[model samples]
Target: MGSLSVLLKESWSFVERPDRLAENFYARMFLADPALRDLFPITMDVQRSRLLQAIVHAVQTVDDPEAFGAYLGALGRDHRKFHVLPEQYITVGRCLIAALREACSTQWTIAHEQAWQDAYAAISVKMITAAAADRDNPPYWHAEVVKHERRTPDIAVLTVRPLQPYPYRAGQYVSVECQYHPRLWRVFSIANAPRADGLMQFHVRAVGAGFVSSALVWKAKPGDMLRLGAPIGTMSLDRTSTRDVVCVAGGTGLAPLKSLIEELATFNRTRWVHLFFGVRSRADLYDLGALNQLAGRHSWLSVVPSLSEDPGAPGCEQGTAAEVVARRGPWQEHDFFVSGSPAMVRSTLSTLSVLGIPRQRIRYDTLTSTVTGA
Candidate 1:
């Protein structure tokens, strides 16, 4: 109702507690939109705490206002999972300011309200700008499936041709949506590099649940239309860096690493690469043929298989992938990328840290969502 610029300036001076801001935001969000209650777990308190912490972490890193805008934009994009709407933003904001007033008590005055409005506007402007930019310059994945091969049990390789070229830096993932089950979507990493033919490959596994995975495993055939999202995730190789690259994956986590390995084989032959892949048993090991080929072509790249159950499998090494990385020697020469279950990510990260791997050098991708069914 008041002048937006004046309110913003006034609010900036009145607000000090970032934690209180976050708490007010979440509290207001849930109060106005009670339907969103189901989106979080029964332990709403924990989720609220984590969300606030993550927001603070993202906001505190704003060296530049534009960077802050991008960060807020990413959060807005991610909020799509909850179907947050434009109207919801206002309600959420009102509730947040109310919560701040109640908590801050004496500090909760008209000036503080103005400052809160200003901060919200700053965040909102950046978020909107970022979202628009993302929509305009979307990631490329306009592909038609040309061939699908059942290479191994639980593993299938799909070769695709795109109407528009889908060039990607290896080690990023794309979300795929199938027509058979319209609403179902799953994320898979590209397994092939940008070959001359322009064909991209995805290595998918049948998890035996969900309409998408089951359809992919039993029903979906070549020539099917599969909508895809642009590549995402920060876990990718920077070829400029000379750091020895160490890749660790569990089960389907191999998808992204495969692309990285291929890319490494093509461009950077001199750089050292050590890939450790973990599987429950021999039955779960997929893409060995391609991995073997890569190893043969690039002497600098070594493939190590770690099977949990049957270490006796021919060519399979014993122990968990983390153990192999630890025992096969300390990782002084390599920077690590890990992807798998949260447990695996946590355990491997802990082990790597104790082994002297710098936290910054060890990157990982953990499933942030709770896996659900149709």
Candidate 2:
């Protein structure tokens, strides 16, 4: 009972394989009530990992009351699309505890079990309260795909106009459910700031076996409908900061950064913006043309393309975006926003830390926490 975060974190290490805990949890849940499985996708891989990441994130943030509360609130509201009633949370909590006990094996003490029980009870209350408080917003918004264009073999840009007004900040991402993959949700960053037309854009890449991404990128058409969960993220701009900005994005990670830049363009006049778009080769530089056009229109914006494999590209930086950022030293006075694959984001953040950027000045979303933004 002393420092619940410490108890949870210490027991968290007892599980050697994180995925095993998730798998066991799901197994126990399904066994308790077979019908509960209907609320999830046929493909459980992404969902499994997402659950694990969410738990780990929750545990880590438990020491910070504000962050932990906000995260639980978001999850509570976001999970509404599943039509989960308050009582179902009890079932989930029980199964989760059982799995945690199994994962911790011999090291799991009664004290650890009691702490987790108390923790989950608090989480349930906070989430339930938050979800109930959100009376005005729909559990999920219905949107129709108005446009779908393949930028490459695996990447597609899709535009969807919500049937009703959808409110969100520029850098926030929404969970999207493809019509073809019912109950399967993936997080995709909105590629543009709020538009007069009220259309939202998502950049998707067909990651291996990702049903939602492949459906959106390869099969979705103009008339197809997609369900969108409420937008959630903390990567948006800080209006109070006067520092110049550095945005680093890799591949489809550019979506949120691009949205931030669009938002920045509306009011920016004094601050300089440097955007580094990273890819493996020239063929992967699908949106360079658009970025270049934006940079041309904004005198304070600069777009740099970084190619890790294409050393022959004449105008591009010849390394990963993180490498290029570190090489262009001392962004000591600027705010940093990084997005990309897990590896790229990790590397870029590590590079920034070595450069002594304060944690508060660096904003990056947890992409791994989502099902898949493939």
Best candidate according to TM-score: 2
Put down candidate 1 lDDT per residue, 1-374, tens digits, no spaces.
23544444344345576556666777677777887665554434434544554434343434345445544665555444444556666776677667666666675677767666666666666655555565544433456778888866666777777767665667766666677765345666777667788888876777644446666656668788776655545567777888888988877678777877777777785678899998888877777777888888788988999898885898888877888888876677677888765577778888898899887687654431211111
lDDT of 2 by residue, 1-374 (tens): 34798889999989898888999999999998787999999889888988887888888778878778877888888888888889889999999999999999999999899889999999999989988988689999999999999999999999999999999999888999887888888998899999988999999888988888999988999999999998877789998899999999998899999999999999999999999999999998888899999999999999999899889798999999988998995899999999888888888889898989898889887753342265
In candidate 1, stretches whose alpha carbon ends up further than 4 angstroms from where it belongs are: 1-126, 138-142, 368-374
In model 2, state the lDDT of residue 311: 93
> How does model 2 score by TM-score?
0.96
Q: Which candidate wins on lDDT?
A: 2
Worst 10 residues of 2 by lDDT: 365-374
Clashing pairs in 1: 11-114, 11-115, 12-115
User: Candidate 1 at residue 210, lDDT?
Assistant: 45
